[model samples]
Target: MANYIHVPDEAPAVPKIDVTVDERDYRSGALKLIKELRPSWKPSEVKVKFFTDGITNKLLGCYVGAVMQDVVLVRIYGNKTELLVDRENEVKSFRVLHAHRCAPRLYCTFNNGLCYEFLQGTALEPEHIRSQPVFRLIARQLAKYHAIHAHNGWVPQSDLWLKMGKYFALIPKYLKDPEQNTRLSTEVPSPQCLREELVWLQQSLSVLGSPVVLCHNDLLCKNIIYNQGAGNVKFIDYEYAGYNYQAYDIGNHFNEFAGLNEVDYSHYPDRAFQLQWLSSYLEAYKEHKGQGSEVTDGEVEVLYVQVNRFALASHFFWGLWALIQAKFSTIDFDFLG
Candidate 1:
């Protein structure tokens, strides 16, 4: 196994993308968007701070100055992310989640980015993810998200392999030449090699019986907010959200336990621990659906194993994504780190 190193909780350094907006522009944009969101709010009174967790978005933290503060996040989508994300679908996901209060309220979406309410909560750390309560909270939220019928009434992308195929096709076009690429280690697999692995993964997971649902395709820890006062968690960053295999969502989430920046694979959850966590998720899922019948251990056990297998898909998805980002993205973070 490749050795994993620990990194600090600091957000990765801002990358060198040729952005259309700057700090002043982001603050100005936030002021404009928020004024539109709350017509009574004066733009002159609005204060915008920089939200640092963003990798692919230029995020400014905006608040209406007051004792009862109304804070919202203004995200300016980075240049070239259009090469990867389906922005229309993302807008749809945010609208639905906003209605349910499971996500930040969508204030407005512009051609370049969007404005949304920023919740009061801390993002769970890598250590926090290993906690049972935190894991269960996220798992149940995933189940609830899976059950939601999009207001837009779109078709489900329950299969991730198809998306993988699409992203893979974009690889050569986006990947920078080897000489220009410094973020990736030499051990990073070639696109052809990664394709072979994805093919095998697709075939291997074809028999899993997990049902399709609308999914938050990307469930990284940084995207989840834990509201202690409400004792609830809300998911953010709908840019990559869509329908996919239920197992893939759970599996991908488990994979995120390692956290970003450090990318510590050693922290990946084990089978028994995974099952315990999954049981809570299934129980909550049944409860959400108003099913009184008990969920069988057998059912939970099956999902546990399948999610582990599906974990391979998560690695490949981001590996391909990082390779493309290394070449195409101008925001200068350590994509390989």
Candidate 2:
């Protein structure tokens, strides 16, 4: 039987005190929340911590001796848990309902907006991921996630084009201004080009007739962890997970393939890599649905264009946000640049 850490006799007590809305105090709150949440597990036992600390938010990872020693990831923020409880519950329900199709696990939301979960298996590094095989696996998994019958319960009412519009608005503010552009990038998109691309994306997304799915919009190599025994992959960090274009998930994974280091791409030419990846993914997706193709060749072509367009859109949206936070706060902007 796998070792399980029992809850301690007494939960660790965190002082009941609040501080001003500052980053230092936020860290303190996160530390305090961790103690309160895992009163049973010793802080020292947690290992292999990975997180990005900045103005956006904080995530902490540590190991607990559970089911072959699993990972406990905690995310902290200032918002009350009530605000997120519904979303978290929705996510949990989505996961549980799809347990046969994805990783099965337990999740808890602690005070101070800290959410933690015990996930099984080792996360895959960019170098270790077998591009063709894993790409196929991810595609099938996404199809399953999108197929769940959630009706109107959790789907975000806002349309995809509206979301793209918000992204379009930020490009100029980040790229045109001397200070902001210097802080973010040296080159700004020409006004004409930006306008044209925005129109193109709006039209493209409008005709995408596929139903929305629970998308892991951020499918960077780091988010996927390999499970050798199951011969499959699991995903984490569902913060960006929500109802969106099914094709968006495919595009995101394809983007990851394109962004690989020169060494990996050398092994597989870009076109060959995409073809193998898509073929495998589509095959698995077709098997799961046990029906005709859920996506078509024409749709895939549109997705390819959107992937590049979204890449540029994300560069500006996240870039400007980082630049503003860095200027307003003490955080570093190197990663943003």
Candidate 3:
């Protein structure tokens, strides 16, 4: 909790390799990239391991030694994800976080993916995050992450509304398969209804006065890695990271309490749990900002209101994202569900 590394004055450039690795036969392409990055390691000896936890991208771990101890993670971008995500901005966010010691070292970028260091830790499950110590570590780490000012001297602005607009525009009015189209009609609100809700969200949350800060935007349990022995946590994946309303970050995390594979809002944190979590976050946030580690009940109450309201936006945003994924992604996850 006492991490004191200063954010670098300038984020160093991540070297880029001009080759794209095909997800279907990633081994050959990954080995070729590894040969360039780690010249000493023989391509034949490199162990290529595929990771399945990710829903948006194909992840591969390449290493010669023990599993995660010394490995390079090769993340193949999802199909058409470039339309949903800002790849250039994603890299900028990655480098900024790495400079602040809040992220893993980005080894390099390839034509269609990124290669980076792998954290030797357990990816948290829904039950694990609700337990002790781990939750607090998450709270503090998020606070530290929020304290990062990557704008240099410019005013921070959230891309939430803009990205939401892009997702909405990209969503197909009708799926190519009529059954999928019919399913969309029954499963979700009409496009008009969604557009109206988006408008309502923009009007409602914009006035809440939540400070804009660098937010993870996606803080699902799977994205969190907890090193039990080290007693710390690290967040992975920056595809959705950017400056956003501080409350939106916390609210999105709160929404994630329901879990992904089997969403049950009943699992959402209770008032007592949220109060404690927010209190811890505020204390850590104050300490990071050079303010004394003290938080008032009123301060917590204000944030509570803002966060819960913003949580609605989180649900809406992902719902739209999933609709797009269902139509384009090859991943087996039921995005529309």
Candidate 4:
């Protein structure tokens, strides 16, 4: 087995593009964000470009003033995300994670928007997650993330089951309008089946007695920024970060390893792979949190089973999240798939 090693390098100078925001009404928010971020720069000197990958927010990449200048990510919450997300609590989570460097830095925030220091590097792909070295590095980062507690305020979902129940309850509202979502209406499991499964899952998982820790509920690869230059990964998008079962967090990430948009389950890690990966994560998590004991083989085996079962919760969480987004969000992504 290869040992995961760190070789840190100075983060390269953040590239700066110099261009002007087009004078249009739709451009107002982006322009406003730039002026708020760097009041010294004029609109004509700032370049406002839309980032195309977001599913839950309007992402804008803004370059203010000149090249070599720092970049900031401007996020406008999607149309109805506020109904499901408490921005105030989300902001507090960001502060705690950023303060310790587990997540990105928050430059500024407003009623419905935020300006974040742009993290350099590509988001990890499924292939990258499959790489042993990259996989181990991410495990360490996630372990570090799980150990974080919201120091400035209350963390959401100390009650994970109730939280998911709330999401499941939204199904009716989402399905009410005939046009709520043409595709998802046909794709999502019936409300009855979903509920029964939820109840059973909660009952079954209760036996594990998993620790309740802060989790990045949305562990999609896109939310993870890999900075090869720094020899580590940095988490972004704290909209769903909060307290939840430790097994659920690891399980959710493994589920995401299945990939997005055609979601091939074949890529999901096998038993042997899960054992190796989960063992590394558990050990690294303990080490980072200063637990001196080694994780036992029996414990790793139990966690492997636990995480695989918890993977079902991850599918349901995102499926419901997409249902809500399908009803209201205007972002371009295959929500039903």
Best by TM-score: 3
Q: Tens digit of lDDT per residue, candidate 1, span 35-136?
A: 566778778887767777878877877776654357767688776899888877677667666656577766666767766777788887888877857777
Give the distance in Å from residue 49's predicted Cα in candidate 4 to where it truly belongs.
Answer: 2.5
The estimated TM-scores of all candidates read 0.85, 0.65, 0.96, 0.85
Candidate 1 C-alpha error for residue 289, in Å = 2.9
Give the alpha carbon lDDT tens digit for every residue of 7-107 in model 3. Answer: 35577768999998988889999988898888998888899888899999999999996655689899999999998888887887788888888899898
- The runs of at least 3 residues in candidate 3 whose Cα sits more than 4 Å from the true structure, single-residue gaps closed, are 1-10, 150-153
The better candidate by lDDT, 1 or 2, is 1
TM-score of 4: 0.85
lDDT of all predictions: 0.73, 0.51, 0.89, 0.73
**What are the C-alpha RMSDs, in order, of all predicted structures?**
8.5, 8.6, 3.5, 7.3
**Model 1 lowest lDDT segment of ten:** 1-10
Model 4 pairs whose backbones collide: none
lDDT (0-100) at residue 223 of candidate 4?
82
Candidate 1 clash pair list: 15-331, 15-332, 16-330, 16-331, 16-332, 17-330, 17-331
> Model 4, residue 180: displacement in angstroms?
7.3
Cα deviation of 184, candidate 4, in Å: 5.4
